[model samples]
Target: MFRAIGNEELGRGTLGHSLHMLLAEDPDFPSSTRSAVDELMRQSELDCAVRAIIIAVTSAQNPHDELEHVLRSHPALLESEWMCDIRATLREFGCFSLY
Candidate 1:
């Protein structure tokens, strides 16, 4: 699941598709998983975070260094349990840290 989420090709849409598949096929998935998916499915909120992160990375002289800053700027993301899922996903993709 984390691997799929971290796939660069999938990007933000990864969580949405993953959630849909899980709900459709694995209705008995853990409560934590369902909660994370529900939060991520708030597309408007997620999009705001994604756009901020993208803009920050684009303008940053060191994009990696701006990751924490970008995330911090998005309060919804910072407060979300889905953020932990994202970090775990990125780590699986060989991204050492989101900070």
Candidate 2:
């Protein structure tokens, strides 16, 4: 069910941290799964950082629109690439929803 995340839960802290720990502490995780889990963790971290900055500046309790606007406004923004990577990795798992 790793591919079943819905809404913004993936980068909202608890879920992401739990997944990272679950994968990291797993003694039997295969190399590919570990790598994918690692990528998910890295991108989740960056996404959380971006979300924090936006919320700090705009004071938006739920800054989904602001985050989307900023990421879509400029292609050069690193958050866009990070978000895309997160989407791609999750998609590879079959049917994950990040939006």
Candidate 3:
């Protein structure tokens, strides 16, 4: 999930916090503590996506550079489809073109 987030150049922030809060507040939710942790991880991935646009706008780095930095720094990002898409986009944009 971290991989997808990184590849997608997403950020982790308030949205994640909010989701966690909402879930925690729900009295009807049923799951073990371990399951809750897993759900939070999923929420975090989604939050990263939700934050991606903001992150891109706030950072001075180029899009490709931002994504690569995220992927490199977060080893888990290496495993996501987002990573693949990021690579593809970079190639499309000539960020890593060999021309």
Alpha-carbon local distance difference test for all models: 0.43, 0.41, 0.42
lDDT of 2 by residue, 1-99 (tens): 254433254443646445544554655433434244345445664444433322222232233443344445333335445456543543464332222
Q: Give a tens-digit lDDT track for model 3, residues 2-99.
A: 22333223224544333433444645322322233244445666345323422331331365765555455454545556457656867587353111
What is the C-alpha lDDT profile of model 1 across 47-88, one tens digit per residue?
434433432333344444455544554455656554555545
**Which candidate has the top score in TM-score?**
3
lDDT of 2: 0.41
Model 3's alpha-carbon lDDT is 0.42
Q: Which candidate should be chosen as best, given lDDT against the real structure?
A: 1
| Runs in model 1 lying further than 4 Å from the true structure | 1-44, 51-64, 89-99
Query: Candidate 1: deviation at residue 55, Å?
Result: 10
* Overall local distance difference test of candidate 1: 0.43
Clashes of each: 0, 0, 1
RMSD of each: 13.1, 13.7, 12.6
Candidate 2 residue 33 C-alpha distance from true site, Å: 1.2
As for candidate 2, its clashing pairs are none
